[model samples]
Target: MTTSILTSFIIIISFIVKRIQADCQNNTLTETTFVYRRVCYFANWAAKRYDNISRLTPEDIDPFLCTHINFAFAKVLESLIIAPYEEDDLKGWTANSKGMYERILKLKETNPDLRVLLSVGGWTHASRGFNEVSKTAANIKNFVKNSVKFLRENKFDGLDLDWEYPGAKDQGAEPHSKTGYTKLVKKLSRVFKREAERTGQEKLLLTCATAAARHRIEAGYEVEEVCKYFDFVSVMTYDYHGSWDGKTGHNSPLYAMRNERKKFREWNINSSMLVWEELGCPKEKLNIGLSAYGRAFSLFGETGMSNGKPVTKKKSSIGIKASAAEAGKYTREAGVLAYYEICELLQNNPSNRVFWHQQMSVPYVSSKTLWIGFDNIRSVTLKMQFLKEHGYGGVIIWSLDLDDKTGTVCNEGPFPIFNAAKRELLILPDHLINKDKKCSDDNITITIEHLHSKMTKIKQSKNSK
Candidate 1:
């Protein structure tokens, strides 16, 4: 009886092992010698999101999914230094408990190559502390000192500055703020270098997330100077259109529509990146920013046209006039929906149809009353191809948490966008990836859950033997 049971266990274990090995051997990631960067942003506020399943804590993050994860929107304090926006960012919330920041860093235990950064400022934080830091040499010095201390203390790998735009006087930016911003960037770069040499540690990566709009780029960035100083310039290529345009448009159109004119012609991913190159940002140092959320718009009563033809008698997203759609269930923002929220809407409503914009190279959902512009596996694959063909530095996601962490909502398995990314972009090296369960296919993602389960079972089988 013991021999029979042991044989059965070996057979079961062998089957599972064979499946993993087959999947791993077939992985395409190992074939490529070229290294690509995958920088993902983490939205800490998502911790407070209503739906527990949708809420993304550090625990939910797959460290192997990205080379660098920037914790979003650390505040610039009144003292001109950086600090966490959330209380959970620090430890001691409970007895001997780690905080969100440490929890995120601990992911490095699984992926030693993973870099965690503290991203200061966002659209909401705007230009608050940036201008202050740029005010004078003294202010800049104090800010840098504290920033280094905080980052080293917290064990972060680097910093990502997401100051909206530096020269937008309309947004309360001081005159000549671009120069000021440049000074700040240069200082951080210098200090970071010196600090690394002083401590005999790896140099902290210094990146800046900037505007996508051509005009904003020109106004807010002394591109040549800024690019020379920073490690990477992350140009956010989304939000090209929304309710702000008072009309329907794709959020991250790959190319400008033929119908677009004037400044609108330049509002596209390709056009913006071209502008980045034009402004002297080396393609190798340029990382295009993509979003995991779709900008939603409500139908404002019109059957828009396509190719000069009426877009059916029914409401459609083809350049239709629009207002704001209702807020997402978890994101709770009317003008946008998380990818998972969009998936929920698509799944719940069978009548809702998905349409592709060949010209824009993105997908959109058009229901009777709403339109949403978003990227999925198909489009993301195309974008990664574009990245490779253009020889750009890499791709950076707006927020990692927004992707569907649950397989049930999208029915595409968890983190489908990321899964597609792993296949299409760079593959994880063997050191970072589980050697026992190597994989590079979209369907054969070797997630943390997969590795942990296998490890547990293998240990149990050994005990059985």
Candidate 2:
């Protein structure tokens, strides 16, 4: 009798093990089947803004929401080595003086599959440091060694080079910046691959944050050569127009306006993606950038205009016009507002009206002189659909900090825009899988629950017998 009981227990244990293995295999297959990357950039400066509820710390991040989290703007030091952009906030101490790096690394406990990358350089960090370091083969070699060490020491899965523009003269890049940029990536890829082989680990991912504009792309990147070394290229598709343009326009429009002038037609997201594809960059390696903030401008004439209608700029207003509209309760920025802040303004204030452009698939809000163009859930859904249909790899958010982290503003839920994108992109199309077998988050959750209950029943039956 005891032997029979032991046999039954062993069988049960085997069954459980088989079930776990099968589930894991299914998950692995799912990931492999649908190759999409949802990359989120966490701005280190956010930790400094303690008073702002939108201020996000490393601990506030939801690891499961993204496939990869890039810690933004790690600086290139004078020694030509990579370092934390905000050392005190990123690797330094808390009020209790605990290391912040520890807190970020600990997030893997919540989602072991999540990849954390250290992103060096940004719009503000576009200094000559990268140029100087990439000048010579020896310099590139040393930089790569130090970079690999820095990433490994901090438990980072990879490195993301965020050089604003390699050959942009205004950005202080060197004359040989274009060639140097390509060489730097090539050397880094070689070294990273060799190191991975030596350490018996997966090859480290190497990616770059590239420009969206055609002029910037021509000035900086040798798309074919540079792309060969990168695991993926994140195209900054937003900021097509801002205070710099001295006019009201979409911060990130998915499609070109129906009546857009020829010169401005190339400014939209679709044009940029097509340009990159034509230049030999694979669609699978391109991740379109999405902004969580809007570009606000003050209009000179009409108070209300339909979406895509060219509004005249206030004469001589070179910078962002101060909004007569009430200050956002949180973001408080003069020229830009977070999606959360925008949602609050549109929802609570009935006078602030919204206009949707079907042609561009974007939205803008106007009240008096205040004009703001931004993306919300609907726009993001459309963009995601565009991405999936076009076979683009995925989407990358300019930041995780600017989104409605608490889910209080949009009322759609936390990371509402991002959630919409993920729901659309991550799910495999029905044609890709068995027609009758539907795969979705909801279906997966139900399956797991059913398995758990069945296991419980099996144990109960064993005891009764």
Candidate 3:
């Protein structure tokens, strides 16, 4: 009896090992099958011109964007954030006090199926607007009422609030208040959601952009409350390491490890997805962030160290810089630079590695005298796999404007990472899918409940239109 039990245990162990290998292999196949959803980031009329002047019009927008694209946001200002006397403070942008209704109407007419939303707040504009609007019931109601009118007049399908952060204090903003922000979001959700249903419009899409780091959430955002109000949230997961830190690394990495001895953690995709999930957000409503531009940095000099020390008389301390377009030369001089337009650097020596934190799945690179860490197609694909495995809502890029256009890699333009995702993941609508005998699992239902739930919402919104 004893001999038989031991033999059976050995067989079971072998079977488990085989199964683990098979699972890993299957995951590999899935990773290759990544398809990124599309989002176009247009902040205001100025951003809109970025596309038009680039000769990218409605017809051109279709190729790069999925049916659903986000019209970045409309900003509202409080006296505290922007001093009235400051020259060119948030200049050359549409104002909430202006007639955005007309602008929205124009957008609606252009792409009826396109989900037009009013994204509120941005990086530099994270004024105390969120805090003020979210603090009181009266303020929340007033904002919601005006927003609904804007939606109705402009024919926007929903509202996208681009609150750069709720708790993190901005340059012009006050400190964080965990409960105040949550209450505000909750009130907005209740009002907007209720109104949408009452009016028989497809459920209004409530969404926000959340910070990628876990600390941000803990510091200010009540993730659970925010998620409750939002249909989904985009994780601004890029910028893991850049000039901000004196190191170089990939902005976005798939399986990044901080230390050599630890297991790799896919921060850009898997970890970001898990961060929200662990925060009690439904995986279906979690979206990942991507960047079209790459970060660039240079190596200064070698010192006492021969191979890796400062040699030249150049400053021992590190300095950071980004490419600048000399006003009139965007397309010609930009050289398709990402964060910093260092086309000149790409001309000399284009590549270097910062270090990949195996435990975090992040990588950084340095060149010349600058260090940059950002995501590329390879890193994006890894993150997409995490999205598929975790069944997150979808993926989002920082701004569609930065997509690679020149045949940098094959015929695929700047949006290669996202394009690859669309082909593999089936984020493209069925109508858009090229019906061919190419796909092996063509007939399989991609719907796994939360998968493409946003698509369903979009369709319902379209039907309402």
Per-residue lDDT tens digits of candidate 3, residues 199-264? 887766677777886666777677776787787788887765454444334566654444422222
Q: Compare the candidates by lDDT and give the number of the best one.
A: 1
lDDT of each: 0.81, 0.80, 0.55
TM-score of 2: 0.81
Q: What is the Cα-based TM-score of model 1? A: 0.81
Better of 1 and 2 by lDDT: 1
- lDDT (tens digit, per residue) of candidate 2 on 1-465: 554565576567657666766776686566645547999998877777766568888888787889988888688975879876666744465466645566676789999988888889998889558988888988888999999998888788999999998989899898889999999999999999999999998778999899999988999999999899999999999999876665567789999876567888898889999999999999989999999888777665453333546444432222233333334556666678888888887888897788787778888886666788899888998888888788888889978889888787688888887788778886776665543333354555565566566667767787998
lDDT of model 1 at residue 462? 71
Per-prediction TM-score to the true structure, in the order listed: 0.81, 0.81, 0.65
Question: Candidate 3: which stretches are off by over 4 Å?
Answer: 1-37, 45-59, 79-113, 170-176, 260-268, 302-336, 339-371, 405-411, 427-465
Error (Å) of candidate 2 at residue 300 is 2.7
Query: Where does candidate 1 clash, by residue pair?
Result: 24-438
